[model samples]
Target: MKNIAIMGGTFNPIHIGHLIAAQCTSDHHLFDEIWFMPSGNPPHKEDEVIIDSAHRMEMCRLATKDHPTFRISDYELNRKGKVYSVDTFAMLQKEFPDNKYWLIIGTDSLFNLEEWYNHKKLLKIGAFVIVHRSGYDEEKSLEQQARLRECYNTSFMNVHMPQIEVSSTIIRQRVAEGKPINYYVPDAVSDYIHKHNLYQLGDDHEIR
Candidate 1:
């Protein structure tokens, strides 16, 4: 069976940090492929003004185009309303029974894993891999990893990612302030943002 990993996010604008983390995890695990799944208007992010789903999807395509193993999946987008992780992974197992699936997330996401919609069922549905983020505390991440393992009786793999201090929130802020985002995102994605004038609305309204 091929080892496949799913990296799901809002990906309002796919950035280098995200790319590095995904690539690092793929290399470390020798996974057959990494699927970057961009969500529709998730309930948690509905308060913010998200760009058109097409734009988000296109940016994801541009960002991962060069990596042969990196792929973009529109499975969640095909469905209406909130598409929870549990539902997505459950479908993956049903449809792609021969392949092993892993969910990739960052240290920042680890802290809030239990709060996700039907998170317990989500944990049980597939394996998970956690990568490092720039500003999060590593010890705290390890502690949370231990806590989740004990609480859910599930295991998580860890990947060492470079400390790239970039985020979709920060990138959007820079664009709104008329600053350059040359290295924050892929050249194609950067050009797409300028050509389309996305995220100029304002700063991030992400819930803490």
Candidate 2:
């Protein structure tokens, strides 16, 4: 059976941290393919200033182009209305009945697993790989993992990697401040952000 791992997020600008996590996860050889799935409209981040879906998708494409195992998926991008993890997993399960699916997330996400939309159903559908970040509470992670295993028979794995202290929000803030964001994001993404003048002050573009 094919093992596919999914790393889903808003990917507001697709930074180096995201790439490193995905690459380290891939290095484990736990999955046949690692798909970078960008959400169209993140329900949890409704108040945040998200960039256009087209641009986010393009940046993800550019960021993962050099990696043979890395791929970008438009599953959530093409879906209408609110996108939930359970729905995405269900669709993939139906589409690839022979393949096993795994959901990859950070420690922060693991702590809030119960708060996600239909999270119990999501856990029942596929396994989870939690990537440990610096300062993350190991005890809490283990507790949550055990709870899920006992309650839903969910499978879990932990991956350790060097943490990169970069976030899309910080990158956007730097751009808005007219500061250089070199090395924060990939070169192609940096150029795209500059060429398009994204995240600049007073630029009134509707975020969808």
Candidate 3:
């Protein structure tokens, strides 16, 4: 069976950290293909909205351009309303019944799994590959772990990668301050931001 991994996020400005996590998870989880799906509208954080869907998709494309196994997906971007993980998984499961789909996320997001839309059903459709982030607990309570084991048939695959605290918010703030964000994002993305003058506009400027 073909193994597919889905990495969904805002990706305001895809960074090296995100790339590393994707690569690590792809290898560790043994996924045949890893698709970076940029969410159109996320229900998690309203404070930091998504950048333009086109630009975000391009950034992800540039970030994973070097990896043959990595791909950029605009499935969620083309859809309207808040992007739900369950909805995406269901669609893929229906299309590829022979393939095993895995959802990649960070340690922080796992903590809020209960709040996600139809999270239980999501587990039934696909497995989860969570990346480690500092300050987030990797160890789960025995009771909770047991429940997850019974409910979703999950497995914990740990990866050793550099801990990068740089975030898209910081990248935007740096752009707003006229600071250099050279290494924070891919060179192509940085150039695109400059050419498009994104986040360089006034305080009221909306991120695409």
Candidate 4:
């Protein structure tokens, strides 16, 4: 079975750090292809800010265009309504039964995995590849680790790359302040944002 990695996120503006992480994972992990799935709508707190779904998908496409092994999937966008990890994984499992999907998530996300809708069911649909992130708790008792090992077939991928402190929220803030966001984001994305006049205001704006 072909091993595919699915990296799902809002991707307000895809940056080098994201690209580097995906590249490293694809190379080191020997993944057949890495699909960058942009979430249409996440079930975050009502106060949380999320950009438009279309823009986020476009940004993902532009950011991953150079890499042949990297592809952008608008699966969540086309699904409509609140996107849940369980539903997405279920759909993918049905369509590509011959392929083994590795849902890529950061260590930060793992801490809150239990909060996700039908998280346990989602875990059964496919294996997860959790990327190690800074300040993420690495300590785990043998008993707890054994319990997790028995609970799900998950893999921990230690991504030893430069930790980029910049986040989508920070990028948006910089844009609102008229600060340069060139290096943090891809040139194509930076140009797209300027050309399309995206995320210029402090308001929740997403450039797909």
Q: What are the lDDT figures for the candidates, one per model? A: 0.84, 0.88, 0.78, 0.74
Better of 2 and 4 by TM-score: 2
TM-scores for the candidates: 0.88, 0.94, 0.89, 0.87
Candidate 2's C-alpha runs over 4 A off are 203-208
lDDT tens digits by residue: candidate 4, 1-208: 8988888777876777778778768767578899998777777734546667777778888888888799888888887778888888788879978887888777666666667898778756656666765565666422333455578754444454557787877887787778999898998899888887777653354322
Query: Which residue pairs clash in candidate 4?
Result: 55-207, 55-208, 56-208, 58-208, 59-208
The best candidate in terms of TM-score: 2
lDDT of 1 by residue, 24-75 (tens): 9878756899999988857688666677779989999999998989999988
TM-score, predicted candidate 1 vs. hidden true structure: 0.88
lDDT accuracy of residue 208 in candidate 2 = 24
Ranking by TM-score: 2, 3, 1, 4
Model 4 per-residue lDDT at 94: 91
lDDT, candidate 3, 67-179, per-residue tens: 88999999888889878988988888888789877787777666677778887886666577777766655567334545776878865445555688798889988887889
lDDT of 3: 0.78
**For this target, which candidate reaches the highest lDDT against the unseen true structure?**
2
Candidate 3's C-alpha runs over 4 A off are: 141-145, 203-208
1-208 in candidate 2: lDDT tens per residue?
Answer: 8888898999998999888888888989888999999998778887888888999999999988999899999999999888888998899999989998888889988878888899888878868989998898888889989998999899898987787889988998888888999999989999999999888877363332
Worst 10 residues of 2 by lDDT: 199-208
